[model samples]
Target: MSLAFSERARAEIDRLLARYPTRGAATLPVLRVAEREFGGIDDDVMVLVADTLDLSPAQVRGVFSFYTHLRRPGWGKYVLQVCATLSCALRGCEGLADHLEARLGIRAGQTTPDRRFTLLKVECLARCGESPVLQVNDDMYVNVTPAKADAILESLP
Candidate 1:
């Protein structure tokens, strides 16, 4: 199997490559495009990127493995990343996480049966001030209580 980049994605990669001195430096940016475009980076996608950039598969794989943002498999539309670091934990992240899991009927690292949501436990979202925070997709919700989280999840389509 091979991965193909859309014209728009290729253009974006070209624009990013121009800012970097070396093609290897463009790896992360290219991976970002691939992630947004294809949803995630599987082995085939990595190989395709290698072919597109004239880099070795190892090089492409290296970048993919190094980045936590890039998933090896596809993910649901909604990614609920709960902060599980010291600060968030102290603020009751564990209870928040449990509430989400029970309400969503899905455990951490698992997607809902309907494939509408994926619950994940992340180290930190850099919102220490917010303490108990959870990132839904690209948006961060700070100091989320169980009730607020339920309301937020219910609001999703």
Candidate 2:
């Protein structure tokens, strides 16, 4: 299939490409633009990004798979990733994860039916001192508890 990027995406890709010395070097940023434009990264999205960056579909897919933090297809508006590292686990992250699952009515790695929240168990957020960190979209909430997590969700628009 012939894929076409939106004008804004094309312009943004061009701008990102200009910052890099090689197309390969521009792959990640171009893929970010694609991710925002396409909603989430999938095979078709990889193909479009590959063509834009002059890389192979395999190359784009490889990068996407390697970066687990990037949004995936079916991800909800709020991607809730609770840190599951040793420090976090020792600090009741498991309970926090369970609470999130129960509250959202979906297990970790699943999105709610309404697509408002996707719960995931992720690695360290590097704030070990503040264990039980929860990342919602791009924001990180350190020292998170079940109650605080619920409050955070309610605060979203």
Q: Which candidate is the best by lDDT?
A: 2
Q: What is the Cα root-mean-square deviation between model 2 and the actual structure?
A: 1.8
Query: Model 2, range 1-157, lDDT digits (tens) per residue?
Result: 6667899888888888889999989888887887788778888889988887888999988988766578888899889989998999999999999999999999999999998999999878888999889999889899999999989999999
Clashes of 1: 0
Say which candidate scores most in TM-score. 2
**Which runs in model 2 stand beyond 4 Å of their true positions?**
none
TM-score of 1: 0.84
What do the candidate models score in CA lDDT, each in turn? 0.85, 0.88
Candidate 1: tens digits of C-alpha lDDT, residues 91-150: 999999999899989899999877788899987678899879988987889989999998
What's the TM-score of every candidate structure? 0.84, 0.88
**Ten-residue segment with the worst summed lDDT in candidate 1?**
65-74
